[model samples]
Target: MRAITFVPGKQGTLGITDVPEPEPGAGDLLVQGLALGICGTDRELISGEYGWPREDPMILGHESLGRVLQVPEGSAYSPGDLVVGVVRRPDPEPCGACARGEFDMCRNGEYTERGIKERDGYGSERWTVEAAYAVKLDPGLGTLGVLVEPASVVAKAWEHIERIGSRAWFEPRTVLVTGAGPIGLLAALLAHQRGLEVHVLDRAADGLKPALVADLGATYHAASDLKAVGFKPDIILECTGAGPLVFDAMLNTAAAGIVCLAGVSSGGRLLSADAGQINRDIVLENDVVFGTVNANLRHYRAAADALSQADAAWLERLITRRLPLDRAPEAFDRGQDVKVVIELGE
Candidate 1:
């Protein structure tokens, strides 16, 4: 079997390597890898900017889609079932959150993620996952199921946003999503589903991004500044981790607003800001600014449902490139496309 392998913290080590076939354990499902999604995280890992160090090469994909080749009898899954493997697993000493199947909120910071942390991932011709950590998807999704992992992230964000909004008679009318990337676009999709007026801001002046936003019945802004958005949004889903944009989102929301920071910003870039003014804005307006990452099984299920209900053609357009497994490395190159997928098998 062949798998994408790389050493953590070592640049230029990503490559395709032959590895032994995976064997299923009790209650484990043996799945044939179908596809893998490439994102900023994968790029960082390949560049040695992120990921935990390991002496041996580790499998390098987390956004995974596979079809069951074998499964334990009496299990909820069966052969030919389409599935996605959940990324984060509970810490050895289960925390309060992890004990409740909410490892996404693991308080100890000791949780292990499939590709980014201490565990091997699903970027192989064959992979084995404990049935408990596998999420079944609609067979109709096909290779599009590769998106479930990233979508799970935004699903968690939306879940948290609505929870915070419920503190009062919250009927949010408008939402501003910064960055028109997959996360931002999906955030806009969920917002539009809720009947909110959605506005997406991206630096792309004219491209598929703006068109995609328009197709969703949302407004798109081709500017770098939040002030150009024209109206104060009731909710801000900040998908661009740019420091300036993060601060701008905090200051540019309506009273009793919620700002969800979903992007991971690289460090070392400093910015000047007025702490007093930013604090005053939040305090006076009863605003809530929170950051969210990762997702539990519940969010994955929610994401699958969201994708299943979405326009199939629109979802298909999100995936702009697909390369075969042998050419997996090319998928990591920075591109303007919304999603890049590595096809592992038919």
Candidate 2:
């Protein structure tokens, strides 16, 4: 078997090498990946900025689709079943936030990221996972199965948006997605399906060109003058890691509007913001800003179903490129598309 392994050493030295194949035992499973998606976190992990607490050689793929080659009996999973699942788990002495099912805030961070901490990752010829932790994907769904994990994050955030605005969530209002990247585009796609007029704001033209060509039912704008457009978004989903976008999005939201933070920054550098701006200009100004992270399996279900009604007209136009696993590093470095899927074993 072959897998991408990261050892304790200088970053970028992680490599694919032959490894022992895994077999299902106890409550575990063996999966054969069809397609896996890479996110910005992979870069952070390779660079050791994501704080994975891992020093030994470890496998590195997370967002992936695989068939259950073997599974413990009586588990929801079965051999030959397709599935998608997260690597995070609840810590026994987890913080209040995580005890309530928020795995991101678990006090014991090591217990929070399973694939990175304890288990092997998906970027391998064979992968093993706790059968109870996986979500069974209907094989009939095809490649869309690989999208469940990422799209689920958007679905969870949407649940938050609906709660904040109630009936006004989609009433002829504008919405802005700060980055226009894959996550940003997923949010745009979701917002568009809910009948809200969506627009994307980005500083770069590299990825937006394909989005425009796809007619994703979205309008694109430069981030510099969002207010000049004279339409304040009722809700903003900030996918840009830059802090200025959050400040600007708060400033440009309508009364009772909400801003959800979807980007992750690992440097621990705080973004400067006006103490009074969020209080006076946002809260006092009636704008709400919140942060979001990974999703549990429920969101995965919604994301898979979203593909059915989401402008199927845009599918081919939306897939920028599909590259083999060996080229995953180059794709991350170049960031050449809206959504890049890593082709795994056929």
Residue-by-residue lDDT tens digits, candidate 1, 86-151 = 999999999999999999999999899998898999899889999999999988887789989999
Residue range 182-297, candidate 2, lDDT tens digits: 78878888988888888887776545453562487678876454664468877889887676676777788878888899987545577777767567877565667888877766
Per-candidate TM vs. native?
A: 0.99, 0.87
Clash totals for all candidate models: 0, 0
Estimate every model's Cα lDDT from 0 to 1.
0.94, 0.73
Residue pairs clashing in model 1 are none
**Where is model 2 more than 4 Å wrong at Cα?**
94-110, 166-172, 206-214, 266-273, 311-313
Q: In model 1, which regions exceed 4 Å deviation?
A: none
What's the true lDDT of residue 32 in model 1?
Answer: 96
